[model samples]
Target: MSANPFSLQSLSRTEAAVDPAFVFDGTMVSRAEFSEKVERTAAWLAAQGIGKGDVVAVWLVNRIEWIALLFAAARIGAVVAAVNTRYRSAEVAHLLKLSGAKLMVVEAAFRAIDFAAILADIARSEVPALQKLAVVGADAVPAHWPSVRFDAFDKPYPPAPTTQEDVDLPVLLYTTSGTTKGPKLVAHSQRTLATHAASVAQALKLDPQRHFLLAMLPFCGTFGMTSLLGFIAAGATIHALDAFEAAPALKILSENRITHSFGSDEMFRRILSLTDAPRPFPHLEICGFAAFQPGWRELAAEAEARGMKLFGLYGSSEVQALFSIACPSDAFADRIEGGGWPMSPDAKVRVRDTETGQLVAAGVSGEIEISAPSRFLGYFNNPEATHEAITADGFFRTGDVGRLRGDNVFVYETRAGDAMRLGGFLVAPGEIEDELKACTGVADAQVVAVDLKGNARCVAFVIPASEPPQQDKLFARLRERLAGYKVPARIYVVDAFPVTDSANGVKIQRARLRTMAMERIAAE
Candidate 1:
């Protein structure tokens, strides 16, 4: 295939040239109008002395203007460092300084949180690398800081389009994981990101007529960037939301006539549980889910009963979605027959053994690796990490366990790091923990497998809310949610799990509770 104009500039051009009157933010911003914002912002970016290859950190929630900054940075060829909107002073400061970002665009205040206060606490002066700061949603700019009035910034401009070399870097910066694990900087260039966009559009079957409202975070990670760009590529109308509250999201679906959306299984369950959720919008088409805990299919079925096509798409922070996607229309036999994805005729899938580093036979479980055009170049500034992730032959090691079938489809077994061998069958802890969360009194839970003299033992840790979570109750829940082998051999109840969030509400540490669980087990 030829190298198409797949960058933001080209995508903007397509949206404007084809669908000029498309509504964004309850008003139609003709393609020309949107492109003009891109230009004016690009020009302002140039004026701030931000040139190609520089980093422009964006710190804000999902909004039209937040997207404007992202496109603006792309147009100027600057890498957009998408900082989590929930980052507190220290976390925000660390990202801004670490990325060597010379400029930042943030919300002055939103909801009840004062972003200005958070910025002030971080102290820009402490980081000399930051030269300029722009705040939206505020009237009075700080004495020492520069601000971009959201309305004024949208004024039309006919600035010249940036050169090819100018819009090279697609995205940069680290994304915080579930636990306090150090953030890993994941980088992708224009080419890699565009490929991802193409994959999403193909998999979801999005088109110009389909409008999508995303409930996930608007950042550089797997959930936001890839999905948004895919919608843009499809020339689909993207309805923006500041955050995901089941009530408002359902209302948005009813009001905006949202046809498609994406979220975690937890979020989808909440939406399905909403008493006021619409029976089904005539325009509603698809609802893609990620990060399944367990009982996800039941929720998907509930959404399907309401006329939405629900699906489970697996992906990672390192490689934006589409590693594997389960279509809602697939029969139970199809799921058992190695699964399915919206694959082009040329796509390939393989399962390889972790121990021998060789391809595995059909129906045999092994590590799932990819040799796809859409995979990232590698992790940013960490060649060793990259080397471990990607193979000598160009395949990206997915770190996921799966098995191939005679039908050429791949069945995901579990995450390589999280799967345990129990009585000759592999047991995935996530599957168990997901089921445990469904218990009436259980607030949250986690499971880990310990190897003991050639045998595997499962340990489970649980969190109770207002009432004590009985082991028998938890066991019954597990029995209902999972197979016997996948159940934990033992269970431990805890007062609370360890978690840390940025001021903006980004989950920084997920595995901290696991460590705490291990410590408690040792003491016992």
Candidate 2:
């Protein structure tokens, strides 16, 4: 981490021949073994007519193939368009065409997921730029999209290509979404990812020796992929999992003594409830939590009390994951709040008042902007959007609301759009949601603000816990626990919240909730 010894081109090459690099199920893959795969996969990409700057869409889970293909594509100076396996027909088709992918490598079959069948539904006319489609776990290939069954290695690893490698070469294209009609493809160069990986490893205190890491998250998202790269930069042994399941993840973490891992609060809470030991994760060093769901505070407190070091994290596809880590040498409460110091030493953060459009003073919340080494080059094929997102001074205007804590340290509050201006004062919906959740019979809650005839009003959507929560009791609790203005204008009980899947994880569609709230109010 002090000096990143591994880059995209030299990833598995620098390690000792017999050094353990990846472990899957009960098998271990040595650096030499993995390096051979990288070479073979590089040759495969070349054989498929993929060249420099071309895109190779990967529609697979977290496995050795996913990792190998990433380095392989980098070896050939091509970009890897990491596609989330959870994506369906339309999403898959959109991403494939959006990236204009030259080749797509996917798992033919994973669990009950029939990837080949899904791809069959997509017409070849949609992805005309695609030259090849390779699938693992099966031998047969579709007629419209031909393949040699990627894992067979029918052809030998051709001589290493004569292409060149540079730190600024585009090597990654991650699919991300905002309030746009379609998802944006985030572009990143070799230098940005390598540098961030090294910085994160150094900040998190990872070592190749004795630090066994788990690839629990999917490789399609920056959150999981960046963690994998951090493992590579640290040269630590990786336990690659195809997908995440609480029962299996617990077994792997406990049996392998995984030193570091990262995931959402809901994921960790499930693991916590299922484990019987007082010190469930005794050997865990630092488990980063995203605080993605309700009850995160309780989950964080319980995890720390069990001897596990759980720290908060903040990052996005544009910045790559682990952009800002709250793992400073501070108290647990402070450290577990996301947006501490930038992982990159050269990075700086500033806050700008939404209304004034000027930099804010210490402890005042505003839009958080960052200038960092790991900042993305731009959104792929979206020049207008890119120009709008980056400021003149080169800071990425992160649409996230946060505050500067006086010393280059910062505290990320919420997404600027999600931050509500209730009663003429800015407030975080999490406060209201948490209050509503603490009420009897409330399983989960989401808060949103809508403009009603000339006034902004806060409203809530709740997922009930078995029995629907009574609005009278919910209002009573909100009045007892929070300010009067912060109380939600109404609450609607439902079986589940609206969600959309991404590489990161399942995210509640807050925008959709706002629309629903507006309609509900209009009908009043």
Query: Whose lDDT is greatest here?
Result: 2
lDDT string, candidate 1, 427-512, tens digits: 66656776777787777776777654455767787778688777887887777767777777678887755555432232313355
Q: What is the alpha-carbon lDDT of model 1 when measured against the actual structure? A: 0.64
**Candidate 2 lDDT, 204-228, residue by residue in tens:** 7776777878788888899898888
Clashing pairs in 2: none
lDDT of 1 at 83: 78
Weakest lDDT window of 10 consecutive positions for candidate 2: 1-10
Q: Which stretches of candidate 2 lie over 4 Å from their true place?
A: 1-6, 11-18, 152-155, 178-180, 440-443, 463-481
Give the poorly placed runs of model 1, Cα more than 4 Å off. 1-4, 13-25, 123-126, 139-162, 166-181, 210-220, 276-278, 292-294, 322-324, 332-347, 405-408, 421-425, 430-445, 451-456, 462-487, 493-510
